[model samples]
Target: MSSEQQSIKPTEKQQILQMFNLLPDVLFWIKDIHSQIEYANTVYLEQVGVKNLEQALGKTDYDFFPPHIAKQFITDDKKVMDGELITDRVELNSDQKGNIAWFLTSKRPIFDEQGNITGSYGITRHLEKNSQVLSDVQAINAPVNFIKENFKSDIKIQQLADVAHLSVSALERRFKKYLMKTPKQFINQTRLEHARRLLVETQLPISEVAYQSGFIEHSYFSKQFRLLFDEQPSEVRNQNQSMNMKV
Candidate 1:
C-alpha cells in the first residue's frame, strides 16, 4: 500500500466520507477502479434520480446521463485514475427533465494501501439556472471569465455588459436574477476570494495583497475582507502560520 494510504486510519477515512454526505449542496461520489459507482452522496442520488444508494452502486454515468455526456465523464474518470487532479471544470449537464444545467466539477484519484491509484472521488457544484439556454450560458460565462481575468485591474460594469453583449441595465438584471448578485458585488466577491487565498498562502504584506487583489487601499481591503470572510486578514494569516508550524 502507498505510504500515504497507510497513514490514513480507517476511522479517519469514514469520518471524511461521512462529511461528504452532510454537504447538502455538493454532489459527491466515489467510483471503483473500473469506473463503477461505489458510493454517492444524498444530493447526487437525488439529482440523478436514483431511488437509493443500492440503485446507484455499480452504475456508471451511462446509466444516468445522455451518451455524449456519459462519454465525457468516462474520459475524465480515466484522467483522474491516471493521477490527474481535475479541478473547477465547468460542465453542462441535463437534469432529470433533460433541461441543461451548469456545474463546476472536481475529481481526485483514490489510492490503495500500496499507493497505487485504485479509484476516484469527485464533487460537482451546481451553478445557477437549470433552465439556462445555450446562449445564456455563453453570455454569463463571457462576463464571469472577464471578471476573473481582469479582477486585478479596475473593472467597469459597462465593460462586463459589453463583454456579454448586453445593455448595462440588462446585464445587471440578468446577473441578479440568475446569479443573485449585482455585477459589482460579483467582482468584489471574486477579488476577496483571491485576496483570502493570497493571505493564507503567502507572506505578502496585507497592503500589497490588497492592491494586487484590486482594492484601492489596504483599509478598504481589510473592511471588505472582514465583511466577506468574517475574519481580519491578519488573523487568517496568523492562523495559517500557526497551523503550518504545527505541521
Candidate 2:
C-alpha cells in the first residue's frame, strides 16, 4: 500500500461508528456506566446542540436535556447497564430549540472481550421520518392531539378513548402497544411537560403553575413532578433563576 493509503486506514470500530453518521434519521450514541457520553454520531451531536465529539464527550444527558427527560434517559441507561436490553422504547426527545418529538429508541449493554459489561450504546430513530411506524400509530392521532390541546383541562381516560373512536379497553391496549404508556400516564406526562414549561418561562407561583397545568392537588403535583424529574418543583425554578442570574 502507498504510505498515504496505509496512514488513512480506519479501524474496525471506527468504520462501524462512522457508518451510523450516514443514517440521517438515526441518532447513535455510546455512554459509560456513569451515563457520560463516550461517543455519538453526528446526528446525535446535532440533536444535543453540540458541535463535535469533543464538546459532547463525558457529558451526561443532564447537560443537554431538560431534567425530566434526562432523568428518563439515565434511568434507562442504568437498566441497560444492569444487563437489561431495552428495545424499541417510545419516548420523547427535544431538540436544541426545545421542540419536542417522539422517538423510538433501543439500547443494549456493551460487553468487553471477557463478557464483562463496559458501557452501553443505543440508537434513536426520529419517528417523523419513519412513515411505517407513523402509519401504524395513525389510529391514535386523534386522541393524542386531543390530549395536547386539552391537557390544561380535566382529562379522563374515557374522554381520550371517545376521541379516538375506541372503547376504553381498546384505547388502553393501543396506547400500551404503540406508546408504551397507558392513557392516564400519557395524560399526566403531557400535563407535567406543560407545567415544566410554565415554570421555566413564567414567574408564576408553583401552585399557580400546577393549577394552570390542570393539576388540581398541589401536593400530588409535587409528588409526580419529583418522581419524574428527580427534583422538587421549587428546585427547578431555583435552578432556572440561578442560571438566569449567571447570564
Candidate 3:
C-alpha cells in the first residue's frame, strides 16, 4: 500500500485531499492504465465544468477535451504507463468554454506493490490568465512575452529592460521578484526549454539545435544542457529515438 493508503485513516486522507483541492492554480488528476479518470482534484472539476467528483470519475479525456487534444493526452498517458516520465511539457489546453490557456504539465506512472505500472498521475500548473501572486508580473508581461518570442536570437538584458520600460537594475529586481530568476537566467531557461523540445521532436543536428536555441557557442550550450538536465543533449535524442523505434 502507498503511504497514504497505509498510514492515513480515511478521514485524515480526505482532509489531506481537501488541502490539495484548495490549491488554486494547479489541476491534479490520476488515470487508470486504460486512461479512465480515477481521481480529479477540485480545481480539475471546476475546469471541466463538473459539478462533483461523481461526474468526472471513470470519464476519459474525450469527455472533457476536444478530440484532437484528447488524443494527445492519451498518447502521453500511454508513455507514462510504459514507464516513461514526462515532465515540463508546455501545452495550450482549451477549457469547457473554448477558452485556451497555457500550462506546464508533468506525468509519472503509478506503481503497484510489485513495482509494476498500474496507472498514472500528474499535475498541470496554469501559466497565464489568473491572478498572479506577484503584482509586478503583470507589468513585466510585455518583456516576458518578448523574451519568449526572441529567445532564439541574441537577446540582451538591456533590450528586455527597455521593452518593459524599466531600468536595468529595476528590471532585474522585478524579474527576480516575479519570476524567481534574473533576466539572463530566464532567457537561458527559455532557450533551454526550446532546445529540449527540438531535441525530442525533430531530427535536427545537435549543433544546429544549439545555434537555434540562442547558444552562440556549442561548448557553452552543452555545458548548460548538462547543468540543467544532468545528461548530455545527445542522450536525450538517443532516448527519444529508442522510444520512436519501439513505437
Candidate 4:
C-alpha cells in the first residue's frame, strides 16, 4: 500500500475533486468502478489537443485515441482495476494529432459512495527533447554483444575478418590499434572478466563460473584471475563487497 491508498476518504472525495480543478497538470478524475471519464481539468483538454471540455469528457481511450495506444491504456487500466496502482512514462503516437507524445502519467482507482471502485484518475505531463540514454546504453553494450554473438561459433581471425569484411592482418591490426589487444587476447580478457563478475555477483560455484566464462578448466580460470588481477576470484569478491560497504 502507498500513501495515496491510505489517505482517501469519502467526505474528502468532493473536496479532492475541487482541488484538481485548478491544478496545472493534465488531470483526469474518473469513476473507478466503471472506468469512465467523469471530469477532467482544463489541462487535460489541452493535452488531448481538444478545444472543448465536453469534447474530451465521456470518452475513454477508445473514443479519443488510436487503436494501439488505446489498447495499451486499457491494459494499464486493468491493472489499477485489479487494485495495484502503477506509474509509468510511455511514448506513443496520437492519430488525432498525427504526432508523437511522451506522457509521464500516474493513475489510481477511485471509489464511490458504496466503496465500489467507480473508475480511475490520472495526470499526464509532456516529455521534452531528446533522451539519449537508450543510444548511450546501446553504444556501451555493442562490443559485449558482438563478442557474445561471435564467441561460441566459428570466430577465428579469418572468420571475424570476414564478419568485419577485412583481411586477417587488417582485422588483427585494428583489434590491437583500437582495443589495445589482439583478438585472442581480447577474448581471453573478456571471458576472464565475465568469470570475475559471475563469481562476485552469484554463488553458482567456481567450476560453473569457469565453464560459463568460456574456460574449460577451473584451474585455468583461477590461474588467469591471479595472473591478471594479482588476486583470486574469491579475494576480488570480498574486496568488491568491502568497497561497496564503504561507498
Candidates sorted by TM-score, descending order? 2, 3, 1, 4
lDDT scores of the candidates, listed in order:
0.80, 0.86, 0.80, 0.62
The ten-residue window of minimal lDDT in model 3 covers: 129-138
Could you say which candidate leads in lDDT? 2
After superposition, the stretches of candidate 2 with alpha carbons farther than 4 Å from their true spots are: 1-10, 66-68, 82-84, 95-98, 113-117, 196-204, 226-247
Per-residue CA lDDT of model 2 for 1-247, tens digit only, reads: 8987777666656898889999999999999879999999999999988899999999998799766567568878988899779899876667557776668899999889999888899999988789998786776888988988898898888888888899999999999999988989988988987888778778999999999999999999999999876678898889878977997
Candidate 3, residue 62: Cα displacement in angstroms equals 16
lDDT of 2: 0.86
In candidate 1, stretches whose alpha carbon ends up further than 4 angstroms from where it belongs are: 1-26, 29-136
Please provide TM-scores, in order, for all candidate models, with all chains considered together: 0.52, 0.76, 0.61, 0.42
lDDT of 1 by residue, 1-247 (tens): 9988888888797787778878776899999998899988888999889788999999998688754356457768888898778876655456657765677788999988999988898999776633344345566778888987899999999999899899999999888765667889889988987787677668999898899899998888999988866678888778768867997
Better of 1 and 3 by TM-score: 3
Better of 2 and 3 by TM-score: 2
**Per-residue lDDT of model 3, residues 1-247, tens digit only:** 7887767687786787678687888889989999998888999899888999999999998688654356458778987898778776654456546764456788999998999888999988877745553243466777888987898888888898899898999999987776667889888987886787788778999999999899989999999988866678898789778867997
**Clashes per prediction?**
5, 0, 0, 8
> Lowest lDDT 10-mer window, candidate 2?
92-101
Q: Best by TM-score, which number? A: 2
lDDT of 4 at 112: 67
- After aligning candidate 1 to the native by TM-score, how far in Å is the CA of 140 from where it should be? 1.3
